[model samples]
Target chain A: MNERLTYESLIAAKLEQLAPLPALADDIWARISADLDREMPTDESEAPSGGGPSLPGTGGMLWPGLGALLLAVAGLLYWYSQRSGIPVPAPSPQSVPADARPASSLPADTGSPKGIYQQPAAVARPVEAMPVPLADSAAAPSTGKLPPPVLPLPDDSRPQPAASASQEPPPGQPPATAGDKASPPPAIDTPIKKKPRGVTGISNNDYRIVPDKKDSARKKN
Target chain B: MNTPDEDIQLIIDGCIANSRKAQELLYRQFYGFAMTVAMRYSRDEMDAADILSHAFVKVFKSIQQYDAARGSFHAWLKRIVVNEGLDHIKARNRFDSPAELDQAEEVPVDHTVVEQMSAGDILQLVQKLPPATHAVFVMYAVEGYNHREIAERLNISEGTSKWHLSEARKTLQQLLQSHR
Candidate 1:
């Protein structure tokens, strides 16, 4: 009779008796409230819980529109180039002229095919009127010599354009001291003569001479 | 004065109306029953509490969808709690591999032995069983789910469900014998 207590029957009997539960209502409700508050929308404006797919917006069109714009711009450029009949220079080994081969004058490593496409490190540009490069020309007589190094002019040493025009000798000419005979300086206190001129179109009638009142008073006294 | 069914119906209506007071009332009403179902499937009381709380949250969210014509709210709530517990067990990845189903040997227990045991003692023993076996045993013996239903819910074969049930029984019998 005691053996008749099967595991199923025993489990069923135990399950019938409600097991003592720890106080979980307040804690469980707190969790529920927190979770619900976090998930549930506060406003009625929330999208209905139908959970349907949203309609596409301009945001989706942006990438394709951008791609089309790029394609159109490229097509317009290609059309313009074709209509102009301008030969678009393609990068090719044969396109490089034999006379344009100055890469040997560059670094030894730059003599490679890649260097043919690359611009020389030093490009010849008329940066200044200074005779400093003449000194380099005086130093290097070789025709294959590299271009003279362009030295930066010091701000203080560089002559102002107006000062150079009025006072300095022309760039190509030597200084007076550098010549065979040194020129004498002009007298510092010499009063310069004033030359009155006439307007070319209106003749001398357009020129009105206003006398300095202070000068006139000094002369009168 | 409203009858118990009327009172419950009023509460249900309130819950559907998104009334916090009604939701709290419903949660408090079924907390014990929910905990009991959850505890049998969980590793500990905290785990059981977590399952209960999450299930109640689900209940509150989907209370509008609950149809009373199908069954009582008690059955509905219990089903939710049991499913929630099962989800937790599944998330633990306990059912990925099958347990030693063939090695389980049944041990006989006297009627006096189970009579002397408390529900808490039985729950402890059940909790000590392997996760899949514990779930299968609770579903078959306590929740009254058939082998086919258990297999469908657990995504296992009916034979596997029976094996887990037998293993659970053997483990429980051994624990009971040791306890005595």
Candidate 2:
């Protein structure tokens, strides 16, 4: 009995008794025929140039615009190159002065003292000029030495005779150098210590300028 | 001078040649069969008509692909019409949820019960099932497809197809019992 209720029998019976579909189907067929007729080309010659029409903005026009953009970019690059100055070449090692070599180029000390004090004495001469007046003042310290005389020197010292120029002092002013004395001290006997101008890390006495080691030692303590 | 097969061949040949007269004749001749296929899958006359037209257009475009060696032209065209109608229903996405079948349990239907119900009543009741289940049931039962064939056509599993058909039968039985 369950087998008798098969899906096949039901469908077969339905197919046999199904109502006709003429009017609905005819309307459908008419519409399809009409649409096909409308869409089909009227003349073979008027059919689209190719099998199918292409999408807009995808063909010839796009290529030309892209090419023009590339040309414009290349032209801009050329213009920028022309307006800038020619590039200068970098200097080679041979072009640099001996003295101008970087500090790192100096030989390492390696704890040796051979050239440790090789800095020139001409660099130390300025220290002597500062102490000349101090020596004079110390000699007269008991009298509370008068303030050093301020005298303006002539700009044309090059033309003056050396001997007479050495003998004269500014009016009512004491000699700053011994040349103004009735009997000047022998030039060689004076011990002049020239302070090196522009050289830091040294005192006025021309000492070998060591760092303040005492302060660092106290900090450690 | 004309066997039915020869007559159908002549109509088909005319249609291939873009003969409007032959197309009109063919449309009239198959209108009943195509409409039955459409009506079974559609909700109303207008919808059925639209499905029929679309199916015919597809048939015209793909007529060259059809081989008489494979099956009868009517069978081939009927397959196309059914597919188009199913596609239309799917595009509309008008299936009911399967939750309604919760109360639908399978019953033992005897030959007497099957005999009492008309084909129209059974089809109407089949149509009332959820869309996915109804499609599977029609393709499997009415169209005489195996589970694998129905599964391939509908893009569902063979198990799913069997389940849908089972649920369809249960629902159909319940509807028939109520009608009685």
Candidate 3:
């Protein structure tokens, strides 16, 4: 019992040691407690009922505008398709005309303007006939001797040489005088020796060709 | 006696029903005691008042869970208020210096000296303690809790609670001694 008394005394001492807190203003308590009496709904089902009608009123106005926007997009797509000229359904080969088929499918010569084979044959015959006529014209000119096809006249507008001067030698040496013509100067008969294969005669060999051995010996002296 | 109990019961019931009048009465009746507990754990008068008001709101909201058989309504409410004050200190991340505990054993605190000090002066000294130590000290000394009860309330070890209390006592002794 004394221990319990001591304990109580200790508690009293501690409480005495503590400062009393300042009183809270009544307004603060009133605000806090006032919040407590306000209910918070636990689920949507318990949520206040009036909030949904306002939303659909705004939502209803949006639908027709969205539909008009969709129709405008579709119209734009159609106009684009027309402008680009894309065939909606492609034309098949079977739809083409028979006359448009190529000529290779016809009989070998039947569909050509003349016969298909005859056209090239006819064209080649004309080319062959053309060269024959050209050869005939050339032969006719030679055989007929047509005055050498009228020799063209020389257009000699410049001066001409005197006819007598063609026979005269040029004026540098004694004109082949009659005295030097005796026996035609022994024919000078210098036998030109044929050069041996691959060997050319030098200028000294010209003197060795003199027929008079005496003249050659005097030349050496 | 029955009238007071019935009156308290009516207020509790009215609070559960979300009645504003009963909530206001409840707040008024307990505000002083709760704020006193709050001031022991708070740094200043305004902080004590703020904590007390918040605790009353929690009490009114959770009044449906209050069991009269376990304790007096006021004591339960006071516990809620004390816990709210401790939470405020925690939320603010207030901590006392660990050096306060280094001289824990040697620091001399005479209970008689504490007894002689006015309640206001003691509360001021308590608020000067680091938050953890002040909280343990208020729970153990002022609120009449054992180390274990303080540990449970503060979610700390019993050893931690004792350490805080000892540290708190040392600091308080130093403060009070200096005042001498």
Candidate 4:
């Protein structure tokens, strides 16, 4: 114990020997007892065997599953629109202001002698810039309903019924004047549904049922 | 491998069972050592008392986690008290920056200075150093922690830890000479 008091070891040894404040022991023990009582958990249901509340489990998975399903639906919608070559509409058309729409999306004002040619949008490309053309401008009836003959366009892939362009001028060229006369309408763009190979020979008669065996003999051809 | 006192063992068993008398007994038995550890790390008696109280609460709650494989109950309790001291320092932001470390002469004080002064006087001089330097001195010298361990615990560089310890030694020497 009679070692030289070097600065390194001196402070450590001195600090250890120094006594703390009087009654610090009593004060600390009082506080510890109070804390122990407060932390003891009065209600049995409120406490777990491990001395804490158990984490809620069943409710956690539902939201993630719902979110995944929503994500998958959104992905399917995006994929279908991409596959079908359809121009998906804005998420909320009514919520957006007219001025907010892009320049290309807006249609131009047209006032020619031929008048407005409104085409059915189902079989047509949804290009808002291209005006509809009449199938036969001269032969067009002044009044009464007439379904414009939707002819098939020359396409290597799916057989699409396109607007007949015989009466109208080819697209992207100069607009034809009344003196130039109207050309035939262009071919339509409808996708023709092809019958699958497996169900080709099945007739509708196979689905039809006779009321009874004698009832089939009484039926007229 | 010193055997524990029968009374201490009985008190510990009672503490584990949440007996109030046993807990109080345990607290009274170790409060001096705990207080000493706390006071050494703290600036004032009040802060020391606070750190001591906090350590006891922790010791009581986590006493179950302590095992014979680790070390003696006293050592385990000392570890908790030291940790509480560190926490107190951290919470108060008591550790001053290295830039604030005082520049003291490298020359050692007279050999008889410590013999002439009480241990309290020396500790008071230690407390006079920047909190950061004091903590390093206590941890490295008293607690036997290396600079690397000090750096890891205090979230500082090893160089910084070394600087604090060096600065602490210098200040203590100067304080010793001044006290004489």
Model 1, A31-147: lDDT tens per residue? 887787677633321433236454446536768998999999999976654444333222122222212222221222323443244323232222121122232233232453333
Off by over 4 Å in 2: A1-8, A41-221, B94-106
lDDT of 4 at B155: 83
Name the candidate, 3 or 4, with the larger lDDT value: 4
Which candidate's lDDT is highest? 1
lDDT of each: 0.63, 0.59, 0.55, 0.61
Off by over 4 Å in 1: A1-5, A20-22, A41-221, B96-107
* Candidate 4 lDDT, A30-67, residue by residue in tens: 67777777774333324343546565563467689889
* Weakest lDDT window of 10 consecutive positions for candidate 2 chain B: B96-105
Pairs clashing within candidate 1: none
Among these predictions, the greatest TM-score belongs to 1
The DockQ-based CAPRI class assigned to model 1 is: acceptable
Worst 10 residues of 3 chain B by lDDT: B97-106
**Where is the poorest 10-residue window by lDDT in model 4 chain A?**
A90-99
Clashing pairs in 2: A125-A194, A126-A194, A126-A195, A127-A193, A127-A194, A127-A195, A128-A193, A128-A194, A128-A195
Q: What DockQ would you assign to candidate 3?
A: 0.14
Q: Estimate each model's TM-score.
A: 0.52, 0.49, 0.48, 0.50
In terms of docking quality, model 4 is acceptable
lDDT of 2 by residue, B44-138 (tens): 66877888888887876667677888999889989999899789867866444434322223455544555677766666676788878778767
Please write out the lDDT profile of model 2 over residues A1-221, one tens digit for every residue: 11223644666566556776554555666698677677542333243445677555555577788899999998886664443312222222122222222222232233444334332222222221223433333334244432222111122232333433445444443433312223322232334556567668655767657776767577653
